[model samples]
Target chain A: MTTNGGADLTRLIEPDRVHRSVYTDDAIFAREMEAIFQRAWVYVGHESQVKQPGDYCTALLGQQPLIMVRHSDGAVYVLYNRCAHRGALLCAKSRGNTGGAFGCSYHSWQYRTDGTLESIPLPAGYEGTRFSPGAADYNLKRAARVESYRGFVFASLSPSGPALAEFLGEARIALDNMCDRAPAGEVEIVPTCFRFIQHSNWKIFMENQLDALHPYVTHESTGRAAAELERQMMARKQKPPLEYHYLSAFTTPFNEWDKLQTVNYPYGHCMLQGYMGLRPRDPDTLAYEAVMREHYGAERTERILGVNIHHVLIYPGLSVQPALQQLRAARPLAPNRTLTEIWHFRLKGAPEAIYRRALAYYNLINSPSTMVNADDLENFWRCHQGLAADGGDWVSFHRNAGQDDEHDGVIASRRGTSEAPMRNQFRAWKQYLSSSEH
Target chain B: MPVVIKKRSRKKAITPKKNSFAQFRVSDDDVILREVEQFLYRQAELLDAKRWSDYIELFDADGIYWMPASLEQITGDGMPSIFYEDRNLMTMRMKRIAHPHAWSQTPAWGTSHIVSNVTLEKVDSRTGDVSVRSRFHMMEFRRDASRHFAGVYHHELRKTKHGYTIRLQRTDMVNGEAPFDYVLLAWV
Candidate 1:
């Protein structure tokens, strides 16, 4: 468990508790960036973000800036954002079309969309020197490996590891369910996202996405207010819109949340069973269902809609609510700083009303301005602050430790409130940190 | 806090009453402009005072409070927005913020708004509707942190018997795309 400096990393994690330093120590955070984020197939960006040949988007993979660009060869490439010549950033914007090549702002060195060196200024100056344009070093350095599943692209910094699909395993259902919901069996990104920085660690945000017990407690006020309004509307003989229930559902009692289940997969991935009843007989929903039925037939449509997934945590980075068409990607900047990109998708060929429903959830429940998100962010900050103080040394994960059902390395929680997801994550974390390879 | 009950109406385009301002002389333009500015000032005051009910009362039954995520966003219907709420949703937000268990509002944040650059963009000569543009800089302080938000405000005011009520209040934040430290809980 100890590294070369004799820092006991193994002692940091226990079966039912974790050392406070895991969330606060700078050395641990740096190790995690190299061991887990760089080794794992980290999510970069959706392929839909760069649909056209020259379109490109920038993302961060464990402090390494990367560009996901579509090439003229009808293939997507993941390359380092740095210019090979002077090490300046190739693309400054978050996303844009590079036209035919990525032109560096500092030196005007241009590389093709596929990251090969297309041209460089002043070729005569480099003729007598060792500098050669054809050298692979002069071309933009690509990720060790890049793969996409259902348009969700991911890249690994290490050359050797499990394939993207093998790593995804059962967790791939999250992406599958989302795509299958679309009549055309595809989903498109909404072009823009809500980028927020939490004054907390990245793991805090990841753990919270599947913490079933906190919603009713943290968002009680929002739920109560929405429920009260719904009551008044019903009293006035009016049916409240479906959007109201989106907040009111937070009032779900703890016992009901316990009735749900969390399935933990290898590689720290986890899934929470759907609790919010997304299906309704509203006119908009009925029309959407009719279209789905027409495109997928009755049996297939029912199966797609019946996936019953609420949220999927593709550990260390992504949290996806497939049924809601929302995904949040977390990027750690420091021990106390984490940046999250919240994105919503439009199900291709689905009715506009369905997209509007997703938009409502995005703005009202997930956006930075929402009461729900505000309370969660507040708690995250407080959790980080408390962990950093000397008041506590160990953070408890003993909710239902020994009660989980395990089969073939997969853990299933007996109750939804079990901390099995955290345990599962640390299990992977320990393996990753203990490995000698970088 | 006493709740104000208002009849809610479905969304409808605000139409100016025909020739409502026909009798007004050119000299009265300044007076009308001052009134619009005063109305906006009052709205800011209510917000700063945490007078949720009073703030909600400034909106028409069908009025919309919108904060677009991008400057290019034209409609709040299909595109994602930071905020797009009708009176009902605003009322819900008001109640939630005032609730005792609203953890984010703990050690309640204080906001000071500076409203300036008030300009009357257009006056509907037919119905007396007014379109006003203004700029605002709001400083919000909580526990140990202070954050500033600067935005341009576009208000569509409907002439009412008592005064002018907001039909639409759109806030276009200059740093809408910038990364926020946490959540934005209050109106700017």
Candidate 2:
């Protein structure tokens, strides 16, 4: 296929391969805001983030700036982060407590947490105009629709669409698996977060989340170093510290990475079976298990503890590792800009040590300053730059393409490194793009 | 607890000239602030050297090490951690990196921890509990590139028969109260 500046969208994307322009073009990005992200059930924030009324956190549902707030009556609402007056952005900070009412900075247009207009700075300023104190126009605008599924908040920009639960469907298991691991059946967001802005299309990240092939190659240097350190510790007859596992996991040869399984679900959701034996007989884990057995009967605890998902992509832009209580929210800044918020949770009531383990991953693998993240960032930037050149027209998802099992709309890749993840994401891209009015 | 710190100051800095070990009366019952300072310095060495296991052993069997999700107190909704683990968490953290599948270590991270401004506070002489405050600058080299990270940590500690273990290690970053910088994989 030759590069066409004015290309037919249909021919550019197949179930197996896609045009590079899908990631590099500027015009396509604008349409994507409406045809896909704006219409999908986008992750906003978790419920526990705003435990009190008037607590709010700013987030992006596609390109729209939205806020997730807990109202006085215990309901969570996703409101546009804009003011009713001169179009000022409310809640500029990523998160904070509003102390019972949201007051916009522009003119102090105070509104209830639910986005209802409470009081205007100058009530008489618009008393006789169409923008009354109680009129909907004077109130903060809200998302087309909002819903919270098991504490994870999701919002749809379009007013009409499949409800959040229906959209999640089989993929709801990703969120469920995380929550189920908790004894109290709940997880709490650790108050701090790590944020990084990647210089790549948002799709590059989503595709990479389940692209099991990259780990062994892209992260070879870090992996080899950690493996050497682990061996050095063992040569001295000393028990190797577990942190080395973080690097060594990447040193696995290509064949070993391919031996693992990857499942590509509908709506672009995908999961990679865990490659590490996280449940080692480490003293800390044994103690944590005892606490779990004490808190949530052994059988139930065992079931919760038994899930083997290494990572999950909640399509579009969420990378959730339920077992480790980690989640990353991706917001596209432009055709070539994306921001990812790295977050991890504490399984409420579990041992403090257990939370620390997740925290280590939060720091080591996902942190913007970590070696792993730095390496990945280089690749993402390179990919975006390369696609914009005359290098190639097609980005192949042809690896193990014909081998994917499609049963009732769900496609499961037999090998871990299979390109089904990219293929599945494109399938969703096609659906969202083709079904749109544009 | 506050009384002990003041008392030690009076005894050590009795004369305006210099605060030397000889200035204070030696008593095994009381732990000199410098001893605690030494413990912290040694811990920093372990981390800088990347002797993770030795770093892990610095904690007691039940010790807790935490890097607050934000600069504020570990309360409410932020992700709330650099780490939230006991020994098991430490073990798992070490284990994952040891695994052949762990990525991110593609280029080994060479880290240097500059721990300074140690504020050694006395918590309780009865329980041998002490609190320490310190500022740190961490620089990591990966793939010929370096990144700098800074934070303050509050450590409440208990002296055990064998050594000292952290009762609580709360890390407050330069961006502690807001959405912060660098995901913390290591114990800062």
Candidate 3:
């Protein structure tokens, strides 16, 4: 609420760099939770996460605990995970079916899947009191605005903002590409996810998403190791497994990474062009292609697969790898802690092997065990620790700074490894944080 | 080679042996159990000492090391897991950790694994296969912080002409689904 005493967000962010306080100061982080996380269109769980009427999954929007549940009417709802009676957590489990309604573990206050107050301990307790059971105040509070774009649900704690569609803009292509890959024109969450806490600021994770320059340098060991294995396989007169490329692709020289472009859209959404050649002419891929052709015809199938996207950074929170059927959602815990939920999806109507391919990539690259992700995670922590100290006053994002081509608000990096995405994100960050006064 | 995509069968790989432990008669159950505990302790020693080569050699040719994301996960199929590595991939993982270019490994991690509560669930002396379960508390220190990882480990061992080898090692951490801090390079 106050901008004095190192809380001035505008003063902290610039075109090509930002003060280290943005990544370290506790006050700035709290302001971020208020201005950016609560007000912005933050992603909730997907629709498929709660497919059944009683299904529910808990998530965090900023610091507020929220639940995304399916009602009996086949609609999804996002409600505060607090009991209306005594403010106890409504759902402690990450996800589970409530049969038909949720009952708070403490007071046994029950609510319908839609968050309506279903029952209380005793009806006569509030008979003549201000607490009317029928009043909306007695029910679990719903998010101010909740919307879904192609089954990927989002919610804003603030009532007024740009609509989700308007906010998504061209970044919707990331979701479209993911769903369009499914022959049935939809995808389903594979249920379990790799959840891990990063000992770094959430923004650090976001900046790393479209950071093309870091991979080949950070993951060099992994890339070279996989490449060496692939070469050994090749020397044995056998083609290497495509999964090897998932790691080896990080060995792509700087020139090749530079060739790919990063498109920075408004609202902090940005995407890097595909560098991982996913469309290999392998047997399993051919089989999957045929399945897609059977459902969507040859031209449409090609169109779906031809949309090349390696990774898409959806502002404050999400980093999506659509082609690989994986997306990571970042939940900021504090100035020094962040939780990331790594989820992988299955394209409906695709071959089981195709699902296997995505799952393999999920395990090989995004999973915590993989050296690819391990490398990034290490840097994130180190960056946070380094920034927290007095050694560095500013974090630089000057790579191809002014070289970006801006057209009608969407900025495209001249080079793949440009820090345009980080700059673009800070641009949106300042806009959101500054506008809180209004 | 040629993208060997091994599709997992829907059927459970290991079922509870039909007859109960009471129904089966094994050759020196106590001795075998003691040997199994010693084998697991030796494996932990190898891993803690960062003996990448000897640690890898403990695995059979067709061995697997899996760390499921959730305690309830039946299989790593269609879902992402913390770790799901075959012997070949596991070898590559070890190699990466040792590579000088692995910047994350600059200050190598020091680990101490405490494998306890060893319990044998099944023993197939005829087939030279055994299933053992244990609880582990692993402490790893790197950089400026130390991380404590506690998990339930399931090891499927096969008797060889020499002692035993690991066919599968699955670690189900108590809070495995929780977000972790930075890298988990050490094998739990």
Q: Of the candidates shown, which would achieve the greatest lDDT relative to the real structure?
A: 1
Among incorrect, acceptable, medium and high, the docking class of model 3 is medium
Going through the candidates in order, their DockQ values are 0.64, 0.13, 0.52
Q: Candidate 2's residue-wise lDDT over A32-72, tens digit each?
A: 77777888988899888999888889998777888999999
User: lDDT for every model?
Assistant: 0.90, 0.76, 0.87
Candidate 3 local Cα displacement, residue B120, angstroms? 3.7
Estimate candidate 1's alpha-carbon lDDT, on a 0 to 1 scale: 0.90
Model 2 chain A weakest 10-residue run by lDDT: A1-10
Per-residue error at A68 for model 2, in Å?
0.8
For lDDT, candidate 2 versus 3, the one ahead is 3
**What TM-score, to 2 decimals, does candidate 1 have?**
0.94
Task: List, residue by residue over A106-223, the lDDT tens digit for candidate 1.
Answer: 8899999989999988887876798888989999999999999999999999999899999999999989999999999999999878989999999998888899999999999999
Regions of model 2 farther than 4 Å from truth: A1-7, A290-300, B1-188
Error in Å for residue A389 of model 3 = 2.2
* Chain B TM-score, candidates in order: 0.84, 0.75, 0.83
